[model samples]
Target: MAGPALLLIALLLATLGQAPTARAEPNVHIYAAASLGDALDAAIARYEASHAVNIVPVYAASSTAARQIANGAPAELYFSANERWMTWLGEQGITLSERSDLLHNQLVLIAPRKDDASSVALDKPGELVARLGAGRRLAVGDPAHVPAGIYARQALQSLDEWQTLETRLARADNVRAALALVERGEAPLGIVYKTDARASNRVSELATFPAASHDPINYPLALVGTSPSDAASAFREWLAGEQALAIFQDFGFAAATSDAH
Candidate 1:
């Protein structure tokens, strides 16, 4: 009886010793602009392959993301499509660290892939309106809150065509949404980032907006919490490095220059 009892005890001890231990990887939450979805996903995948951290990303309009963070969202990192929202977060007293411009983008006019019309000259007065025709609308992000829309508005205003097109615009929640409208043929035209147009096969680039027509299109990145975890800090640093910049460029985003705002 003693031999059998000792054998059972040894078996149980061995089973317990060989059991896998449960460990939770550190989680880092990222809130970024919708336009960054693809590029950021690639970056996250690359980072995770070599690290033990779990990354969770939320993509939305910069305004929506910034407002959510101000409302106490659990985002440890915030990447805005423009500096306005980041500055707004600062005004709201959201503690930020390692803030800097991350990338630059160009605004473009796009049409459905099947559209055969010649590229419309933005400088030619009435060209855009004629392109829209009767009852058609130009799809764009909501200029009131979306960074892309604001830039579009600035460009149109610079061209002296805002008043004519303002009421005929189809406002969307984000730049991607605007791109979708044109891709789906729901709107004959759309204004979006060059990267956004490039990502979709359903849309064709019509023209690139003049950079001087709007404020420099800048994407800003920052750590959002009072004290970000070491993993989050490391990820932020990695994103600003040359490897990440190369990845961003592959996705059609230009590197932000030191003098870029």
Candidate 2:
């Protein structure tokens, strides 16, 4: 009875910002995909307002965060944009548990918001390459690692446009960084998530890639760390519930947990 009572007290203390003898972590650090930056930040704000424990978020490309986590980064959770990286983390035996898909997004081609730019036919080959304007470069997340870049590559390849645009690719660290390149007029074109284009005013949607062009876009959320804490698990539950769903929907993400594994 005393042992169980002590354990309960320790949990309460940790929730209140006090650590006990074990890995009594008082907060949850979330390493999320860059595309989720604004939505996740807003959700964290809402969660922290009512919850006692702090939920710190670290946003980056899923690839970047996963690589860092593999190197022993201290994040308590990892919410990735694609399943491949999440699976990679699982293969490395770094995930603590509760891996599941939470949201879905659409891939889009975006160009600087302009009045005279003609629309390109995304269903056909070479249309994207031909509309490259004077810049001739397309900003994309690093295809070798970033999920968005990988999807973009897949879409272009499916449309038989990869070879034409490969040389003009401006690889960015993450999807948001790629979007930033277009938003700042550094690149005339970019491939990004629909939510990203909605979040920015300087860029507008040019076309959306067909679903068959790439793998399904599922944002999987998992507790990832060698020493996972109760606070992290509890927060993960809250995030996966309807509370976070509403926030994600507002940012244009769809519910994709029907077949979460």
Candidate 3:
């Protein structure tokens, strides 16, 4: 009996010594484009279910998000709607070497559901301003920086409508805010990403501008230098996986090809 008890005590001590250690929760901060809100939320939700890390995402225009990360915002990952902003951040020494193209978006014309006769052709430029009744509003993201806004301006300029509608333009800081302005009926029409229009029930897509109208929309995701936690890198890895690509496709964003810019 004494021998058995001693053996049991030794075994218990050995088991205690071999016990697994608890893992520390990881902390992650991500800066993302406003256009990615829905898709990114879904991707993050799926990642959090399996990982012990908690991710905090800040959504803004691609340019604005780039500025924040470059200006010392504590972000571990940056997802921009356009590669220009991503390159800008890289030039400023804010991005890592191993970055991947995340997704692609198409700029589209959207109008309030109540606006009946405003359907424009996909290939033709939107003449929303000319079609508007008195006091009608035309919404566009700030063309100076917002990628969607820049595309919208290019389309308008190509169609020779830029000068005619210039006075009625209501500029929003980002595409989402411009979408909101149109959804609320404050603006009769807005230009935003196709994904954003799908996410909103209040607005309806009038048309999609031709791909030739402006530069391609590519969203490239990269790890910023200040990634305080490895979880950020893990999340970036998962974003390039099939699961995240499927989620992005479901949200109306195209899966970025390897050759995607």
On lDDT, the leading prediction is 1
The TM-score between candidate 1 and the true structure equals 0.93
Error of 3 at 167 (Å): 2.9
Root mean square deviation (Cα) for candidate 2: 8.1
Local accuracy of candidate 2 as per-residue lDDT tens digits, 58-177: 999999998888888888899999899988987887855788888999999999999876667987655777788655799999999999999999999999899878888999999999
Alpha-carbon deviation at 30 in model 3, angstroms: 1.1
Cα error, residue 220 of model 2, in Å, equals 0.5
- Candidate 2 lDDT: 0.88
Instruction: State the lDDT at 203 in candidate 1.
Output: 86
Which candidate do you rate higher for TM-score, 1 or 2?
1
Clashes of each: 0, 0, 0
Q: Write model 3 residue lDDT over 45-140, tens digit each, in one string.
A: 998999898888899999899888879899888888988888988898764645767688898888887646457764444445555657776888
User: Which regions of candidate 3 are displaced past 4 Å?
Assistant: 1-21, 115-118, 122-126, 226-229, 259-261
Model 1's alpha-carbon lDDT is 0.93
In the predicted model 2, the residue pairs found to clash are none
lDDT of 1 by residue, 70-131 (tens): 99999999999989899999899999888999899999999998747568798999888888
TM-scores of all candidate predictions against the true structure: 0.93, 0.87, 0.86
